[model samples]
Target chain A: MRPLDWVVLSGTLAFIVLYGLYKGRGSNTISKYLLAGKTMPWYAMALSIMATQASAITFISTTGQGYVDGMRFVQFYFGLPIAMIVISSTSVRLFHRANVYTAYEYLEKRFDAKTRTLASIVFLMQRGLSVGVSLYAPAIVLSVILGWPDRLTTLGMGVLITIYTVTGGIKAVTWTDVQQMLIIFAGLFVAFFMIIHLLPPGISFTDAVYLAGAIGKLKAVDAKFDLANRYNLWSGLIGGTFLALSYFGCDQSQVQRYLTGKSIAQSKLSLLFTAMAKIPMQFFILFVGAMVFVFFIFVRPPLLFQPIAMRDLESSQVQPRYAPISAQFDRAFDERREAALGLVDARRAHDGGRRAQWLGQYRQAQARINQARAEGAGVVQQIHGEKEFNDTNYIFLSFVTRYLPAGVVGLVIAVIFAAAMSSSSGEVNSLATVTVIDIYRRHIRQDAPDRHYLWASRVSTAFWAAYAVFFAQYAKNLGSLVEAVNVVGSLFYGTLLGVFVLAFAFRRVTGTAAFIGMLAGESAILATALFTRITFLWFNVIGCAVVIVTGLLISWLRPVRQPVAA
Target chain B: MINSTFMPTHRAEMPDEPPPILGSWSRIYVLVLVYLALLIALSYGFTRYFS
Candidate 1:
């Protein structure tokens, strides 16, 4: 990046941290630290909710995902609005009325102390690892672009977020997140328009869409209800709804966002705002990725987009053997581009026969290009033996560095950093909230003054921040950082959502029955995950069913003469 | 089974009518139903536009 771009990047980030500290410096009470004194209005709450969910991965890998896999990935969020509605109707009011600091705290009051601990443990395990991946998502890109070691980048990003988050707590996180999200949207809008403006002359936007569609990049709708299909209408609706409920309703990172609202009505409205905006925002991001995919059709993209992968090959002992394969791939790419351009020109001329001929030829050329790219990937993998070799995450970054103008490049890079900070800050804040509220205050040092716990919140924030950074350094082996996080979430979201459902809807189930049901449900989900090849989204549905059935059955078998209030 | 002339009495006067509990969750069903409708509509609209 140029010096001017670095100035913008540094200036934007610095302003956020300094602003958060300035606004939230005098937080002396635990309520101020954890719930931001319940002073936030609807707008701040809505944006914070979005920012926490829209990680650096959303900005970086999502575009890349669109570029590689097309817009089909947008189907994953098809269940979000419904999930929001469910949570706002049920859990939102419940949490607001209970006046709890963490979501798990409600579990204890509604169930038992042990159940709360179990839920908290599940949250910590999932969020901790996810926070690590969230940190790594942007670190990998920045490190590759700036030529910095991954460790330095990870530590730098971690420390920067921890500064404001530890000082201001939830207030800092929500306020900074609001600012960060604004910048993120601004940066993405600029990049989106610039992409359209940069498209080659004589190729209309409609033509570009047609070409992308022809290549199967626009397969966003699939009617089939195949269990293995990850993102179809069926899985997205049913499985996706459960996933959303678990994520937004139960996850402290999200629960903490709306929990800051002053009134139940305000919190419900805030979530409703998210419900309305979430899909459009995601659509925009995925569309950016799709446009990036179209952009690559005309440009001569690299055989291997990942800098690390390319570096390994360039410096390896097998460089000589790999040189010919790389050349072959480049030749195929050029041929494909020529063919695509010919098809575009034919369409412009309004000649049906010519257009059909050129389109057919372009299809064949595209096939050859895919074959060549695959062959090159295999060679690269063979050379870097025993290592994961997917480059989908790096593709969009490569495009920005290689193709985008200098100042825009830096702005987009800053956008990525903003996304990383937005997500990681939320993670650290929630982790600290749960740690201080559920574990520290509940179990240890229960009678300590609020000041002691207030200090403990800051301490825990720093600890989790450091832990996330450490985890980021070692997560390179995990293939597809996006999928890895979701897979982990899938493993636990269902069971957690089930437990919550049992708490609210099934009044007959005893606490013991619900607790045992959750354990059994998680075990069943994990077993299915291992033994079957069903998509991760379905896991949510299965797990929820397990909890409801088992809890109800156990209740029926051991009918309490008089039911416990909890 | 009651005749048309058998009118229901007010809760304060009638012995059969139960008193309203302070936090009886009488509104929860309506709230959940409304929310469920919104979720379905929103999700459907998203898929239609983006897909």
Candidate 2:
């Protein structure tokens, strides 16, 4: 909001968008417009792919996760590398050899048009449903932390994305994503070092690590196998792999990124690079969150990271019930800070006995601190009359705005906006591609001129952008919106992945069998979601299993009736 | 086999090329997997050391 912050934010955004437009300048034909003329190098596609997967909200919330929970959540990506390898070997070569514009377009070649249409519709529904939430949720969170209007945030993001996407096509989106990612890296590094430097003078980085580990913040690996436990090694490796396959293999947005690669080797390389990069990237973000937690140990954080919630707690209506909780939080904060210093001193003296006593005291104070924080949440909940409340996502946002210097603040904010735009642009672009290539050109007018479809793609991109902005405004009041969006994507990915699995892995399965199996898989996943308490990650497993079994059974009962036209 | 009449038959099938660094695609894949294993091991070590 300061003059310097404004300059940095605006300048950073303007450069990324303009750079995207410049790089995408030659996208006149449909091929270049949709697939970047199949000339993109591996690195650009790799970063673009990563950007699309990790959005603005993802960045904010991940750091917040580290502050509140711990590094255990990183296990969620254990399966990603495996999924990448699978896709690199199978879908990369097949989609390249098939020379398809979208992944669903290849389904039409392997299965029937109905199957392709269904797969495309599934992607459209899942991606289209979530894109608005992805764009708006982060903007609203930023609005709360930075005191900006949410509508304006969403509008600014939508406008910047539309300008580059419509003008330069996928080329614009990819290159701009590259810039966004690079800036995001800069912002992250700056934020990380700032947190380290801001730590209490007595605490070295080693001490900080020891302190975080003592508090269980560095528990990055959980080997215990539990079905419902979200971040265990098994679920992350198994369930995570299924979700990643659904994402990178069946999802048009990701498939389209690598399809733009100059050759199969480049496309596969892009995927492999992402496989190597994604986990470390997530670790860095979460580690930043852990550092933020360490910084707040000596310097007290607010009862809740959400400022509006804090102000609401000050209101006369809530103040009577909240005062005692506020007092308790202050007491716990002092006790925790003192205990942390004592523990540090004990460790420096190599006094194991004193370290144990101080560790116990520190954890007790931390527990009390958490309790007060919960009571604050309860008061906030009373105001909203919600079932449950969490201010987890605001931890890092509040930290960045309050502590970081002015120019750096703007850069970090721009990094967020860049993430939002990069993610949204990819989804919006892919939505348009699937629309024009899979639906409009495939069904409505198969013989439309290339120029006609090119214009259609542009028009569709604008429409989705406008639609995302409009939808984001109404999405503000919906509770658990991020989880809802994630669930929506997971709901369909399994069945979608199943159909593709049948196409590639089971060549004996007929188109009718595959199509019928998809319906069965969809129904099974929906039933599982509604009737069972199974975690959403396992939804992909169940859906894929049902589809494969059903497809095989049906194919076994039937024979080929007619030859496919060639 | 499915219908291919409307498929873009005239579009040349891009030949698969070996990775620039690894001697073969299989070798590259093994390297990536090995790298993943190494990352997991390091993360586990960090957890153990700190916790």
Candidate 3:
């Protein structure tokens, strides 16, 4: 990044932080500190919800996911809008009516103190680790680009988010999210336009699409019902729906966003805004990745995107032997480029027959090119003695650093930083809320005054922020941070969602029944996650089903226990 | 007996002051239907276009 780029980056970040601190002015009480006095409007809630969910991982890794896997990943969101509507109608109203600080509070009312404590514990563990990944995801890229240690980047990002969150609380997080989201949108649009501008003279966007399609990069949907295939339509709809429901309905990070809405209507409207906008927004982001595929079709890409992988390959020990494979990869890339260009010309001429034939040839050439890259990656694996080597996480970062103009490069990097801060801050806030409201207030100091609890919230926020930063230091070489965290959530979200659904839908099921059922459901989910190769999204379905079934069974066998008094 | 206070608010009284922030079932129904239709339509279009 150049001096001008640095100026743009620094200026954008400084403005957002200062603005957030300014809005965080009136927060003194616990409710104001944790829930922003429940005064956020629909737009802020919507953008904040999206910003929290769309971490730096979404921007950096999803684009890389797009570059490597194509647009099929967009199918994962097929269930999201539907899930949003369901949650809006049910959980959204219930939580607002209860006016509880954390979602787990309702569990205590509907089930028992033990059930609520169990649920809150699950949330704390899962969200705490997830917050760490959100912190680390952007830090990885900054560390690579700036040639700094990962620890410095992680600590820098973690501290910045923690300070503002500690100062302004939820209000700061929401207001800053509005700014971060705008920068993210601007950065995306800029990247999209620049990609179109750089395409070689003879090719139109359609031609590029057709060329990408020839090699199967345009595969947006797969109708086959394969449970193991994570991104297929059925998995996306059924599994994706459960995952989204568990996330938006039950997860505090998202619950906290809508909970801050001034009224239930505003909360529902804000959710509806997200439900309507989320899929299209994700599609556009994924499409940017697809365009990146087209961009690389005209140029050469590195064999491996990870700096460590490259470093290992470039070291004196392996460079002599790796050179031939690198040369072969170059030749393969050049051949694929020529073949793709030829197919593009054929399509442009409206020669359908020749275009089809050329497309076949082009597809074969591209596959061989991919095989060579894989073979090259395998060589790096052998040299380094670490078997797992996938550079899908690196593709977009490599493209941005090498191709994007200098000033825009800095702005985009800042956008990634803002995204990391917005999301990690939300996670930290939610984690702190759960820690203080669910654990500290409920179990440790139930008689404490509002002012004491307010101070405790700040203390918990700092503690969780420190914990997340510490965890991030150890999170190296985690393939696709977004997918890894989602997978982790899938393992638990299903059962948790199930517990909540039972809390609402099955009134007769005693707290004891639901509690026992949740335990069973959670156990089943963990077992499934461990022993099976079934996609992570399916875990939500499993968790929800097991809880419902186990809860009912337990209720039928044992006399109903009375619900705990709030 | 379960505490009366923890019981859901009386259905009759709920509508009188009807909390200003309530989700409408009718609206939710319509929204769900529309999105379901769009997903199907989009899927069909993408399949046909790709085919």
Q: In terms of lDDT, which candidate is stronger, 1 or 2?
A: 2
**Winner by DockQ:** 2
Candidate 1 lDDT, tens digit per residue, A1-566?
A: 77877888888878988988987777779999999888888889999999999888767878887788876676677777778778876787777767789889987767778878999999999999899988887787778866868788788889888899999888988899899889989988988888787787867787777677666666665657888888877787688788889999889999999989877766876787787777668767877888877787777777778776677666768688668777776776777677778767776787778767766777777777677667767777786564555777787778777777867887888888888898999999999899989999999989998899999998999999989998898888766665777788889988888888877776666678878999999999999899998878888899989988998898889866653346
What is candidate 3's CA lDDT for residue A250?
A: 91
Q: Can you rank all candidates by TM-score, best first?
A: 2, 3, 1
TM-score of candidate 2 on Cα atoms, chains taken together: 0.97
Q: Root-mean-square deviation of each candidate, in angstroms?
A: 6.8, 2.1, 2.8
Count of backbone clashes, every candidate in sequence: 0, 0, 2
Candidate 2 residues lying further than 4 Å off, grouped into runs, are A561-566, B1-12
Off by over 4 Å in 3: A477-484, A561-566, B1-25
Which pairs clash inside model 3? A264-B21, A265-B21
Which one wins by TM-score: 2 or 3? 2
Q: Which sections of candidate 1 miss by over 4 Å?
A: A312-320, A349-352, A477-484, A563-566, B1-51
lDDT per residue, candidate 2, A392-448, as tens digits?
Answer: 889987888888888988988988998899999999999999999999999899887
